[model samples]
Target: MVAISSPGIGSGLDINGLIGALMAAERLPLGVMNARKDELNTDLSAYGRLKGAISDFKSAMGSLGAIDKFSVNAASSSNDGVFTVGASSTAAPGSYSIDFSDNGTNQLAQAHRLTSLDFADTSSSIAATGTLRIDLGGNSFDVVIDASNDSLDGIKNAINSATDNTGVTATVITVDSGSRLLLSSDKTGAANSVTLSDVSGNVAATLGMTTVSAAQDAIFLLDGHQVTSASNTVTGAIEGVTIELNALGATGTTETLTVSRDIGAVQENVQAFVNAFNDLQGMIGYLSKGDLQGDNTLISIQSEMRNIFNTAPTGLGTSLQFLSEVGIKTTRTGELELDTSVLNEKLAEDFNGVAELFAHDDQGYAFRLEALADRQLAIDGIIDTREDGINARIDRIDAQIENFEYRLTLTEARYRAQFTALDGLLSSMQSTSNFLAQQLGSLPGSAAG
Candidate 1:
């Protein structure tokens, strides 16, 4: 027998409506679980935002911790009319005298260029099949020519498009006489002069390139001694220093080059440090009023960070040991403020001491704060642990939802099966009643109608 899919058809009891009501009541728990999952997801998103803010704060602290690095040596020339100088962070603070004399000596490097003998036209085809090996200093590449690209323009395109072509540019220049292929090396000096030879065919001979400009190295006199460089930007002339020669100095012109600590940079760094800390505090304030309200992790971080204000670094051989001594102080509102006048005075008084106050190896506030941030962001840190716990709870809730949904499915099926059987029973009873009524009518009335 086929199961009665339309349960109310035989019994006329609206079995489908009744089962729907019971199933709705059974699904109440699912709604609660879904709500809980939504809440957890919202919490996770909040944490993600919080984590980003913390990472940003950590980076700011790290930069400030290494703030002394910016105070490293700055190379400068007494007169920058002829040349300029730059020094690395490790460059020592010192002074050197560089004398320049324009006694028929070149001070700027020249790159090598080649001009191809005039061609008939851009479409002129020549030797079609061979390879030309192009050499530039120690770097070299081979150009392959075939029947498809035998024309002058084709060869130019091939050379320009070669994967291994190192710092070589091919250009097609047309003149009143004819078209010419111009090849130039981007590198400077005689060592990087362009040279080529035909490996398989007469491609090199067909091009007929001649030196337009010969490569020349730069020569200058440092401290009464001659210094030579392949490039105008000279390095290793002074340890960790680079001097760029723009023009040859006049005869017998000597300028003083000084490498010294940039004391002025400290003021800017201190201002930036103030701004960064304020921004972090602002973010923390915003989060505290919202989803992270009463959160232990955030509270702990805030408390620990504030704890630095009460304590001062000790055992440092510096007159400036406290932040307040350097114009950094806290307001009644609990945000940081800088006194520029005091900071400038401190900078002029003792610049290195200020650097040590904020960036010393272990006792500095910047170093300590940065280190604290590292621990919070590290693997299995407090933030991660909290997030992980929340995720685990969400996972368990998901399992519960899945299991409950399965049970709900079974429960709905059981209700439908029971209603279907009740409908069949009621239908059978109605048929029996109809048959008995017909038999009684036939016996009593003897077919009166």
Candidate 2:
């Protein structure tokens, strides 16, 4: 008959288990909130994927929106070993006869090979002191050769480190006789010739440096007109064309250089755009059949994209007005298929017309798509608005779940307090009943009478 402090011990019932079962019922709303939050999170992730796909499509459209992309020109030389060529959009389609006299030369000055003289490695010092005057083209600068920089390698380093030494580089070349300091001009034209003279000391005569190669101009003839270039790469010879002379063409042997619109590059760009559009379409299709089934936002986006394909472009003053005209067609499965032969034929027939169809000043298909994507993906746009709505719902559900959890805690505590008191009261009643029965049994004289 010890005081039963434990709730279940006093009544011989599982009071704690009962309280747990009651609290489980109270937590039902929390489960619902969690499920709803998971659904919203899935939707948020889906929208982010959709936004990324659309942005990729927009970038692909950018290439098609520019006329220059379609106007790419390729230049080819009859003998590529002699010269390789490149052309910009401004180049006119034509042919030219190019003749080269000799390969362009760079101005070079080498120090006479010193046989007996030897110094420490590149960092060693010499006792010689002098100021070396260097001239390149018309510019002149003086390099001071002091004890700190008097060695052969030190003079090379000094020439290289001079801030005012333009168009000149110095190097030390090893030979069977000895190491020689080699100085070369960066420029190749005769006007960029280099010379060296020691004004203060015998540094120039001691180094034995003299000109090995004189700077000369590159002489060539384009369409029977004389052309002179300072460098091997010549521009402005043909408008929008840069000619890179590899090796000098044989004297009097004219090579043919041809410039034409590059239909291959145009085809590649178009194919890229088509591939990007298909990828976007496939992503939308997957979302529609999966997590976003019956979603109105996804349905609207898909409809608008399909409409763009079907609609004929406006304001183009050409026969090629639609993508279909260029052999781009939509299939039943919502993907684009390209007929390369037909597209190539169209490009060959009217390159300008093809360019206008996709990149016209106004109402071109690529331009329209670019504008649409920009608006839809901007801040506060449709995708962002949808995400905000989903987030707001999730926040509200979280608040409700927190409030229910607090209420359940208080309710469990109250139930435990009441049940404990009841167990104590039942124990007292049992004790009272036992005392009364014992008193009755003790009356032995009354029972005999």
The lDDT values for all models are: 0.83, 0.79
Which residues of candidate 2, in runs, are more than 4 Å off?
1-23, 101-127, 133-135, 138-142, 163-167, 197-202, 395-449
Q: Which stretches of candidate 1 lie above 4 Å from their native place? A: 1-4, 72-87, 91-106, 119-172, 179-181, 194-209, 220-227, 238-269, 431-449
Please give me the total number of clashing residue pairs in predicted model 2: 1
Cα lDDT of model 1 by residue, 1-449, tens digit? 98756777888889979999999999999999999999888878877877787787777676668645556677898778777999887688899887654768746788998988777888878755699888999789998898888887898899999998998988888899998888898988879999989899888888888999888898877877888889988999898898988777788778788998765666676777787777777777877888777788888988888887666888666877789998999888778899989988887788777777888888888888888888888889988898999999999999999999999989999999998888999998998998988888779566767
TM-score per model over all chains: 0.79, 0.79
- Model 2, residue 21: C-alpha shift (Å): 3.8
State candidate 2's TM-score. Answer: 0.79
Per residue, candidate 2 scores C-alpha lDDT tens digits across 215-291 of 77767778888787777788888999998877766655779999998888888878888998999888888888877
